[model samples]
Target chain A: MSAPFYIGYNAKMPPATAAFLRRWVVALFVAGAGVAVALAGLQHRYGDGQFEFGIVKSFDGIISESPYPNLIVRRPIGTDAKDVRSRVLLVAPGKHGAQELVRGLEGRAVTLQGSLITRDNQSMIEVRPGTIAVQAAAVAGDDGVPLGNFTLRGEIVDSKCYFGVMKPGNLKPHKACAIRCISGGCPPVLVVRDADGMAVYFVLAGSDGGAVSSDVLDKIAEPLEITGEVERQDNVLVLKAEPGTYRRLE
Target chain B: MTLAYQAISWNRQKRVYDTVMAGGVLTFLAVFVVTGLVLHSEITAEALLIRALGTGAFLLLNVVLSIGPLCRVDPRFLPMLYNRRHMGVATFLLGAAHGGFALVQFHALGDVNPLVSVLTGNTDVQRLSEFPFEWFGLFALVLLFLMAATSHDFWLANLTAPVWKALHMGVYLAYAALVLHVVLGVLQAETSPWLVGVLGLGMAWILGLHVFTGWREWCGDREHAGATADGFVEVCAVADIPENRARVVTLGGERVAVFRYDGKVSALSSVCRHQNGPLGEGCVVDGFVTCPWHGYQYLPETGASPPPFTESVPTFAVKIVMGQVWVHPRPNAPGTRVEPAKIG
Candidate 1:
């Protein structure tokens, strides 16, 4: 409300006292700054460890079923056959040594030789040289169907051949049955030998594909000689049966 | 003008400032403790309590520094200005706790020497970008310690006003360093943006208020000097004096306390040296003029305190001639320059 008051009142003090207090304040400031710097430094220094590479091999083994072109070989450490242990030797494409070794082999086979390395406690062989061998089979007719209790013998012409019957009523049969019938034109029927050297009814299916009745299904495991034509298609082996093509072996 | 009146006013203002400061400090401490305890996961209940106490103390100091100037600017806000030094002391104690806890947490165990680890643990010395932020904190704490030590009236009396005032001014420096310490050290190291923002804002607010007040004061001084230099110097027409009443006159940046008592006009410094209480706003209850702010009584004739207070103010030469009051711009020693203003 009143005019702003400014008093020019200056107090006199002993210079010594002033100096002491100033020094004290300065000292405190220095100490505080020191502590802050120290703490920051400690945190930056001691804080936390940082890891890279994949699993060379797993403890679990691999599983494979088929061979050669249709070979479903499972490697011990991996799923695919290519991942199986093999050598990595360098050789010319037309080199006879590697070719001769593969030609002499019977079925799907691979041999490799190379140095091995261990990663994460798993062994991995880096092959220097390798060879793969495969064997070929024969062929048969398209619509030959073997009768019941026939000794059917045939080389596999199509390795992927299906051997099941058609459905009874519909012209279109179930996929599993139709694939077997159309691919080979007949199912690979089983045969069994009796006490006499004569072909007897083992298991049979009608022309129209239907379910295998329990009466015949019971004798499927019996061993018998089969005679038919072996067929190969799409790197697969199949057999086509014909009437009287199967004969009981004495 | 009596000593009793001055003492009463001084006691009243002191009480108000003290009480407000103390309450503010306690409240801040309570909040700080509760928040700190809730926030800290690793600290035990006891440690949390201690840490809270420490935090409260530092907060109290901040409040103390903030409220004093605020109260001076507006006395209506006096209630908020109480016990500011108490709050300051509390803040110092809180800071001590924070420092102590940090010391124990980082340096208590293992092969590393505590002192060396505190200084070099984080390899700050090796890093060029990392500065001596810890030094700032240390300096701030030391400043606080000095302030707390000299807070009492005993140190005040022993150190004298000028020295004590100068020392106390370190609060501003300490606060500045503390702000930098937090910014460069805590905010830089800690990635939490929200926390950094809050701390920065608080510091900015305090600085902004101080700057505003300082600017206002400068503007007021300029305006007053630009206006009339001789107009207000005339205290009164010589015939106007009725008995013991005093008149306030402003002349060239000086306030003159003019009094007409016992058939003569006398002049003394209108501003009280203690807290700048207006002397002219007071009255001559006896032979002395009492300051309205804290009622510091000065002998109207001598411009000197009666006894133990030992306070004094400069007296001005005056003339009474032809029913006009006139005063000389130059001030003279009290008791010797008792001549009345000439009447015109």
Candidate 2:
């Protein structure tokens, strides 16, 4: 086998050509380095419309189901029941074993310190890692009356996009992208309608009340009939259901 | 050629090639991101970044693949083939960025492992439209990585030309994978006809180039028509070869570069010692037959590199009769001196 011809390039070339090649090399390096710097400086993380990094603000509220096992804290207006409905809750960064921590504090008022961010006019407290603390024992607050074992239907969507990243994160068109978001550990939320004919979201949980993230990977963006007991945790709604109870319609 | 191997035996050409490629990549990212933000005004910066890097790598790979066939059809494009590995390595690095960032964004912070999630997340392969296409991209990237990893001269020397060529030829398979990846991934949702059109045209162009050049070569070989008794055959008229350039012809079952230079004609084996390049396509530069592929030089009289450069090719016995060049079919020993036949 003969040695490769390109073992060396232009070993014997005219001085003029060599100079031209060298100058071209310099031009390339200058242009490349300048553009690289611009790109590096332009680096940024765009949170799905739902997340915004902000100052650490402490808030007190009752945990409620937003849809399917996600936590939304409801701040009380007064002892009167009519004013409690005016509150909203947003939770995020739900990291640091947050799925389990929020479940254990169900129906309890908790004070959490984290960056407060709003999405679609809905507020969510992005709890910093390991900053959640319970203010009192799990006690029933003046949340709205039980909405009962509502057997509602809608597609389960990953909340990351539904809340902000994508405008309409549910239905057939967004199915594959939504499924991927959920399977990657984004919280899954069930988009359904209430008896009053209002669109409501429930943070879904497994029947055993554990993180149903892995369990719902196959059910994303697919319409399903989910039967579960809905409870008001502060301002959010939580749907507790098992894998077998949810039947696929399509 | 150096006796020892460094990471890269840097040259001005290679330096220029890499620098220009780097500039292209960075400029592409800047333009893509800025335009996406301006036109759509909705896509996240991160998503634009991923798309930019992904597209950059894809386009560069296609460019790398086209360079070879392009050079075959027109020797003017041969310079693109020199230091071509720099482009391959840059493409791989860009691909790595896209793959890594995508893994973190779409696959990480989930309950399952990121890599595992990509595999298990899309079990809906039953529907052809929804079949998991990321897997194809992953496979292609792996093949590209292997090719890029072994692109250096050290590997080429160890593996030999044929083996090295075969290994790098895996780029075609990667190209196939990339085509499917695009068709199944972005094409699944993209509404633009231009993207699909560009893809179809790119594939057609590449396939057409290969077929066109292959057919041309086959026809040229079949029509040699220079089989003469006693091994001497008329390859072409002396006027057929351009001054200081070669006329490649198959005479006596050997490809020979018959050069008309300095009012004399010299016949030498057309296959370059380095990479078996078609030396016939090259031109004489500064008193040396310079291989167009990488500028490897040889003394037309001796079929050997100038002093201190040991590479040599077989010289052929040539004689001019009535302004026509006739070459003996049998090759002379490598580096053998053969007096040029003076032209009228």
Candidate 3:
């Protein structure tokens, strides 16, 4: 008896199991396809640009006009440069005296025949058909002649001043200040001296204490040919110069 | 006497069937372990599923092949062979899952037409050098699907045994294709030394078991020689027996169990038929012989019932002269022929 043999041997299984397997396979395929479709839709949406926006507001007052007599009107600072909107006023000789001209214009602008000078000792005078439209500073005066042809020097001291007072006492003492001095009634200026001990003047303009307009400030270090005469009243030094006295440095 | 009779009546068929089923289940579990550990990857999720399916299919086929040989060696393993088509269907279903996932992942989402993509998507197939290797997996998958589709008893009855057997022989082609599939697709593509070693060891184990068992059968021919007439039937001397032993003999191509115990000799059908395990290979313990395969037993003299086991083998007459043991091929009433072998 080697080993028992089974003839006609065969194997069988329940039908339900096969049906269940087929169902499971079909469900997996459906779920996988769904995910692929969802991902493709997301990719398409992000590729196109179609989103949203939001806006905001601000304010300020208009200030000075240009000084040149024959200039055409131009645009306000914030507007695009090509647009022109504002105007300038003109003044004739004898129509207004310096004090009356400076007075009637409280918030209004006026034309005056005078030079522009810094309180720290530098000066310049206007020549020929000279006129400028500006709102007068609080301490502005007729006798406060824009100084020129005067020599003065001192250690560059700090002061709060803007363009109004050129007299010594007008500047406050010992206050730390930027070159743009507001309280002293004169814009701050740099003080330099020549070898002959003559005061060489350089006017600070704007907030940065560089010299004034190039035509007037460029001859700063050398002797300047000026037509202004100095006037002293109550120990305050001021220079009164004829418009023609303004000349380039020698 | 009653106790001896009670001990010899166990059923053998059910026992053999149970063993084969258990073996098939174990093989299925073993394949699951291999696939789960080896086929993990993110991009190739579909590929992994297919590989797992292939592994499961191969395991089922291996189990099916083992069942027949195992049943012949131990009829206690036959019950497992009875319900094995379930395993085959399971393998087919798993293979389908693999194919389905591969179709959707690589083909449905691909740029080409879905059918074309499935047919040509595998780079291994497109490359000329890898053609046959890649085609082997496709062929195996198709073969498994066909077998699984026709795995019902309905098909078995309709097809006839020879035709059914012939059709099922496609499993061999499937096996060969799977071997090449693994070699080319997994081994060549993965290039992992660990995987290579594992695959090599598994193939070696299966081949080794098959070869060793086959060799053992070829070398062991222990059948008895000379037939002697006793009444109308011829008896043969199976082998020399000691005081309490037995030998298996064949008469007219029918197997019979010959036993010598308590100073007498007796014979019975080698198979219990209820499960078909060798009755002679059983031991003469407590005056009854217990089958070495599944423990079915029979009394050496009466060949009667054991409690809880009602099966019996056909009893034959036996005798011994000199040192020779002999068996009568014709069966007789259980207790009539009991010529015990001489103790030498």
Q: Which candidate is the best by TM-score?
A: 2
Ranked by DockQ from best down, the candidates are 2, 3, 1
| Whole-model Cα lDDT of every candidate shown, in order | 0.44, 0.69, 0.43
Cα lDDT for residue A160, model 3? 17
Q: Candidates' TM-scores?
A: 0.46, 0.77, 0.37
Candidate order by TM-score, highest to lowest?
Answer: 2, 1, 3
Better of 1 and 2 by DockQ: 2
Candidate 3 structure quality by residue, lDDT tens digits, A1-250: 3333222211222234334434543553443333223222121100011111111111111222112111122433234665443322221121111222223333333334432222223221211133445544422222223444564443232121111121121111111111112111222233345787554333333222122222232222222344334443212232333323345332
The digit string of per-residue lDDT tens for model 1 on A3-72 reads 2221111122224433443564355444433432332222221111100012121122111111111112
Better of 2 and 3 by lDDT: 2
Question: Considering summed lDDT, which 10 consecutive residues are worst modelled in model 1 chain A?
Answer: A164-173
Between candidates 2 and 3, the one scoring higher on TM-score is 2
Q: Against the correct fold, how does model 3 do in TM-score?
A: 0.37
DockQ, all models: 0.01, 0.16, 0.01
